[model samples]
Target: MPNTVASKRVHVAVGVIYNPHGQILIARRHDDAHQGGLWEFPGGKVESGETVCNALARELHEELGIVVHTSSCTQLLEIRHDYTDKVVLLDVWKVLEFDGEARGKEGQPLRWIKPKTLTKYAFPAANTAIIDAILKPRDSSFSSH
Candidate 1:
């Protein structure tokens, strides 16, 4: 007899913490955490009853000790990838400003790297496009009065 079961997707929040220098922040996952020792944007899973933006704010504060105003975050992209054990949907955002300096509150190492240098780091599969998008310059249009 064959067994039937369904796999549930896991939802996570990710932040592209940037500075005026156009550097993006990356953090090393704790050795004991999932995908440990790998580098990624500083963020984590969204808890129940929390909006995506709210989760981003919370995760940033918890992981980096920075308090970001939820309204200031801009939705950058969403990534969906499948792992052998589970499917993950990462909601990524770009935080332009926040309070306090980012520290590895979780005992992880953090670095701010230019977008051009991101390719040199080994990130989870889902972050590939996110990095590309971050490197691309935003389109701007102006209207003359």
Candidate 2:
């Protein structure tokens, strides 16, 4: 039998890493990987017993070479998406405070994009909410810059 959505809520943590100059970070998924050829926030799966914040920090350090203290992240948004083969619970965070420079440690193409221009990149269907959060966010903290 196939796994049910409720039984397979894969927890993934992502960071909307912003720089002091007001740019958002994004990375390109490998062409041969799932959801390939699209851009996405830097993140990875949340292992058992790990909090979302911990996962974010771990993923960012591993994927982007940035050091994010778990407490420095603000809860941004959480979305659950169901594809044909799996269901993913994306725990997104807004990280403005962190140490180290951002680099694509995973060899993926990385960019720091202005928030208003986030829509130009091709992203996965599940990323629509995240894009909305960046572009037309209900939260007043985000600026048109």
Candidate 3:
């Protein structure tokens, strides 16, 4: 007989925030949560009836205490990964402009490091593509505005 189990699907909105100094922001997940203790770009799960941009803004604010200017935010890429228990779809965005300081409002540790140094930190498997997209040279398709 064939297996008939299906994993729950979770939609997440992720932000790759950058400062004027060219450093990117990252956060550590709570040690008790799924994929815990890994460094990740700050973000959270998208809620029902919410657009990815809206989710990004809300999650960023709730997680980092910063207001995301959705108009200036750019969709960098999307990634879907399946784990043993669940499937995650990551809607990644490039957050170049925002208001207020970025801090861990939820008590997670935060780090601002150069893009080249991203490899030094540990991230979930789903974030591998996000890291690649961040490290790759920005092409015309990716706009700063």
Cα RMSD, each candidate: 3.7, 3.3, 2.4
Residue-wise C-alpha lDDT for candidate 2, range 1-145, written one tens digit per residue: 6557457668999899999999999999999999898999989999999989998898899988889977768877899888775788999898888899888887899999999889899999888899887777675556432
Q: Write the residue-wise lDDT of candidate 1 on 1-145 in tens digits.
A: 3322126577898999888798989998878987788899988789899998899898899889999877778888788887776778899888888889999997899999988999999887778888877877345212221
- Pick by TM-score: 1 or 3, better one: 3
Taking all chains together, the TM-score of candidate 2 against the true structure is 0.90
Over 4 Å off, model 3: 1-7, 138-145
- Global fold similarity of model 1 (TM-score): 0.86
Error of 1 at 24 (Å): 1.0
22 Cα displacement, candidate 1 (Å):
1.8
- Cα lDDT of model 3 by residue, 1-145, tens digit: 4443254789999999999899999999999987899999988899999999999999999888899888878888889887776778999998988999998888999999999999999998889989998888567644544
Worst 10 residues of 1 by lDDT: 136-145
Q: Rank the candidates by TM-score, best first.
A: 2, 3, 1
Point to the candidate with the largest TM-score.
2
Top lDDT model: 3
